[model samples]
Target chain A: MQPNGQLSRFGAMKVALHRLAFVVLVAAAFGLMLLGKADTVLVTRLSHAVTDALAPVLEVMSKPAASVGAVMNNIRELAAIREENARLREENQRLLRWQTLARQLQVENQRLRDLANLVPDPRPRSITGRVVADTGGVFARSLLVTVGARDGARKGQVVVAAEGLVGRLTEVGARSSRVLLLTDINSKIPVVMEESRARAILVGDNSNRPELAFLKAKAGVSPGDRIVTSGVTGAFPPGLPVGVVASVDEGHIRVELFIEEGRLELVRILDYGPDGIIADPGPGAAARAGTD
Target chain B: MRPTLWQTLDQTARRLIPFGLSLLLLLLAIVPMTTPGFLRAGPMITLLCVYYWAVHRPDMMGYLGGFSLGLLEDILMNTPLGVSSLILMLTQMVVLTQYRFFVGRPFLITWWALALVALGAILLKALAIALLSGYVVAPGPLIASYVLTLLLYPILAWVFARTQILLTKEP
Candidate 1:
């Protein structure tokens, strides 16, 4: 629409402006990174505000994803129904038998507790929340739940699915919270071998299976050993089922967590009370909660 | 020098299309898909949008739009604030600088260029994340994401092209 010479001049100006914009943007981003590093509270507040604003929209967007997941699950479930039915029938019979024994043990346990006058720990309370977003990718593992500080969700609370420990509540927003899954590289939980009572740390490495670390020398942990929360760290209550040791190689002991992070829909956040190991997080604790 | 109301509204709508599309991409990236392997390392859908808009409508989606979208992603994904912002801003710069070569290329050529750009951008993102987190991120999943993003680009590009047509054809 213009003369060639004029068009070329206009093109040069546009390109120059774009280059200048690029430089300004890069510099601004660099400055933000430095700001993020120097002031975690500011970064956390910024993240929280942004996440809070987007939570409702993200929740709406995730509905189709959840339905697709449900449909896929139904298809998979349909494939082996006959064999699964038989297996479940047999397992139900076995569970019925164990139910009788468990009742007897409960009666005896109550009597022993009465005799010993042991002050029972308060039963942990829980609040349920829906998964609104999944931030996991190749590098980090985390999910944003629909519950937040207004719902009494706090940092360091244990998040669980029906199967077992999902992770811990790391960041609590005004209307949303971030759950750091146990498979995240930053996740570390204290666990004990159910059979052997040997203590170790469950460390995530951004894989489906987390590894057992800092096991005592000659602790005799083997594949298939059931692991549970030791309650020693006070972060998690004792006896919560964690996972089974999947393998015991020369140096690595991997655990397949009972929770399937992919199928997570509703998660329960457990409040272990004042005496619980996770200290009551104060104002600045939000920024420091993920550090350790 | 003031424009009529309809012209102003038309210009506003045109300007918003790229930003709105890119924001939609950012939202899509975080959608919780339970499908194994797909959601774990889902294609970088937002990155594809940045490249598409940079190629087709650089006037509308500038470095600021790229930075804002990238920052939104970083906040949503809970990564260091500027990691994605920096990568996306640079992606815009790269695509715009090479715009002349790509302007009239065949589809395959553009596709290949996009794949290469995506690969480099994702690799740069990985390096930045590792450096920021002070941990060596495993490259296995990153490579998987890169490949998946490359494979899905054509489909996404087609979608973006349709949206562009819609934007340009609006009265």
Candidate 2:
């Protein structure tokens, strides 16, 4: 109502519509759920098309959230300058000592390599993309990256963040790809516990910490051990950083992922060739993989 | 006096504000909240937004509008297509059935009713996820989100009220 008690010419929708249409829509929703199971290929195609079509809208929309995050981070950093300075000072001293040790080890490694005439694995090609959207709610843990077949992005490519291996490109479209994060139910990565070199499958159960499956009995695994891809399945490169063992309760070992999904903004998709099979070969390729 | 075609279209667009604003909130829901503990349970803005319209201006956000909004959310959020549509339409229909009771009630009573409806809706969502994805989500996050979404209702309703006034004011 206005000052004169006059209603706006456009605002009086004071009644609900007919009930038949509501019933039809609800039934259609039911049909959609059934359709997914009956025809997964069709459902997958439709979802991909929808994601590809909305990629630009998501890209444009995400910029504002990122800007807000940056601003807030700046304020937070300003507030904790003194504390951060103290922490950095101590970290610098520790890193300086590790730097010396690393140099010595590198020299010894080089000498050994020269003596054995060892070969090194060539680097894989990679493309970086911005994360546009991720599955909402607790239903799924996949990300829509703003790169696709048009940009040379392909399915099965390993996606990594600055810290380490994040996930893999499971679905690729013309303008976007769905990265199935390491925390999804369907994801399983062949990994090795670095301390003991025991192999296992890193399985996700839609939780923050994915668990280790098929681990060898009495494998000497403990808390704080590193986990890396073993490259056994011919899908991922060996020795890529994955995570650290977070716990070992009753033979269940969970890994704390290196990449926090909240902080993940950019991801690099690496094509390690169609075959991850490491074998004896000539000057261009073979089993001489070395971590830099 | 006969209104022109443009005037009629303008009137229709103005009435579509509730649906449009709810769609915008739906998009914002998918944007990962930097806030801890809230990431897993996104703010269920669409639920309350649709409820608000279904109670106050049901003619604007009819079945078609609710269906389209839910379908878009499904497509964008990577849920089984139509799950959201079913949930939203059902929510709207439920609210419409109780329209008379909520028509002139105080904000608190309407909010109290929302808590009940939202709890049911969240449980349904969990069931859908479990059935579709085979992962039983922890109940803690779902309950936490239910409370948070209810807490956010007053603020969203206040904004919708203002917009409704603007839309209905004599031009």
Candidate 3:
């Protein structure tokens, strides 16, 4: 690859040096990959540090696209307003009926709780954060939200969309945090089929539909069954709305997450301070959560 | 004759423009388009930038700069830390080695070269991520991004071509 006969020894030496630099850089990159695997702590800190340092700049840079997206969404919403209003009106009527029944059941449930002397579920506080960046790639599905450790967000806190549980915080920074979306391969959420009570792990395979694995054989799970966090592991709160079973393939149970691909502009990160639903997050997430 | 200090500074800044533009593209890639189903359809602007400059101005776009930008993308996108670094540097290496052939070629030929290089790049990235994570990644979404990258080369190439002409013009 010497230049077409304008090739001097000096030019040859420069190309050699350039290739050498590339080789050295590629080696260094592979070395960093090794370091990332062997020392997740260092890698995690580096991710947090860089993301935290650049959060404001990232926020500002993302605004133009955000505005454009907002405009597009506004137009679409405007177009659908008539149908949406009618649907909401019908939904309001149905909800009004449920409201009276819910009030009656509330009294009965409270009376039963008093009779049994049961401890009540503590209400966890929540903090709202804007979706600053969708950090997903071909391999990992993730997001960077504006809320972070400064805002009481932590490693194990859960993120909920308007529809359902979307993801969990895997890394918390000073002004931003990374949400490992339920579709990421590294994510293994302990969820259960709400109707059948069958326990399984919702496994992300880098696909739109995260599949359910480890379901008990012959478990009566079919399409339309609801899936929720099982509370089997305390990493996530139990009973957070997750998604519905989209299909039940041979062994794969594909779930359609409520947080659609493009509409996650804002998310809610529940505070997992003392007396939160995460009673014991085992040795992994809780310890990291406590440290930061 | 030797250039004056201001002229030297202006020339230096011009040399940095390609890298600056490439960085801007990388920053914008992580921002969502906000329309559903359009996220995966966005092209790899960084890859195209690297290829465009490597073909036209290899001296300006160095391996170290490309590697740094790749690392930045990894941090911003929350991918495995070094994966993008490897993919981008390797892609630049391909263009650097073969850019002479691509220069002054038909637009179709240049686009064809980008198509081949982009294909190799995505497959390499997918393979690396699969090996690292031990999960079988679906190829559909990855290929979708690649197709968009293919579709983008012509439009972005015209912009880069204009910038190159500007660089060569008299001040």
In the order shown, the candidates' DockQ scores are: 0.62, 0.56, 0.61
What lDDT does each candidate get? 0.83, 0.80, 0.80
DockQ for the candidate 1 complex? 0.62
Deviation in angstroms for A225 in model 1? 1.7
lDDT of 2: 0.80
lDDT score of residue A269 within candidate 3: 90
lDDT string for model 1 (A96-213, tens) is 9999999999999999877755555547788999998777777778999999999888888898888988889889999999999988889999999898888889988787788999
Candidates' chain A TM-scores = 0.89, 0.83, 0.86
- Per-candidate TM vs. native? 0.90, 0.86, 0.89
How much is the lDDT of residue A141 in candidate 2?
73
- Highest TM-score: give the candidate number: 1
Query: Which segments of candidate 3 are over 4 A away from where they belong?
Result: A1-10, A217-219, A274-292, B33-36, B41-43
Runs off by more than 4 Å, candidate 1: A1-13, A274-292, B1-3, B34-36
For candidate 1, state the interface root-mean-square deviation in angstroms to 1 decimal: 1.7
- Residues B1-171 of candidate 3: C-alpha lDDT, one tens digit per residue: 799999999888888888787776666666656434655444567788888887777877788878887787778876667888898898888887776797777888878888898999888877887777666667788888898889878878898888888887778
Fnat of candidate 1 is 0.66
